[model samples]
Target: MKKLLLAMGLSTFSMAASAAMVDFNTADADGNGAVTMEEAAAALPEVSPDAVAAADSNGDGVLTVAEYEALASQ
Candidate 1:
């Protein structure tokens, strides 16, 4: 149980670190206020098209920093 807890904690920490490393400003690429699908895709290759679509909750075809951060955290 202790080992499992430790592993989980480590996983959470790593996810947080990765999310922090890629802030919205840096990922925006074009210096726009929002991150486009292309920018999000480029920043997170592991994320699927569906995931990107889901992250864009506003349906504006772009991810705000908060949205991108949330997606990265996942």
Candidate 2:
């Protein structure tokens, strides 16, 4: 049973990894390939302000494409 569960978990992980990802190049506005606070908020309007701030690692009040991509990849 343990082995079966492990295999199922691995299969689920593989399926998740193979899923299509939203291209950051297209998501980033202003043609800078980075997501500013306004851009991030625009892209994910449903996200709370606190969540947006949390994603801003540098505390620059913005999230870059790379940063958003990293978050999505996880």
Candidate 3:
């Protein structure tokens, strides 16, 4: 039971750590909560242009929450 509890606690801790929030106010290179291709590039310049373009969901020329989540995953 102790080992099971420890494992559960560790799992929860790891999930919380990995689920850290991404701050758009700071991460928004274009001063927009939504990130444009250019802005996303500035946030993570190492990422390929194709990757940035792909991140622009809704086809609004900006990264939506889904896109930001995708970036966070990377």
User: Where does model 3 exceed 4 Å of error?
Assistant: 1-23
In the range 34-62, model 1's lDDT, one tens digit per residue, is 99999777666667989989999889899
Ranking by lDDT: 1, 3, 2
Clashing pairs in 1: none
User: How many backbone clashes does every candidate have?
Assistant: 0, 0, 0
Question: Model 3: which ten-residue window has the lowest total lDDT?
Answer: 18-27
What TM-score number comes out for model 1?
A: 0.69
Candidate 3 pairs with clashing backbones: none
Q: Report lDDT (Cα) of residue 40, candidate 2.
A: 59
Native-to-model Cα distance after best TM-score fit, residue 66 in candidate 3, in Å = 2.3
Task: Give me the overall lDDT of model 2.
Answer: 0.59
Segments of candidate 1 deviating more than 4 angstroms: 1-21
Model 1 clashing-pair count: 0
Residue-by-residue lDDT tens digits, candidate 2, 1-74: 85465446545654665322434653465568677767655545455657767877887766776677765454
Model 3 collision count: 0
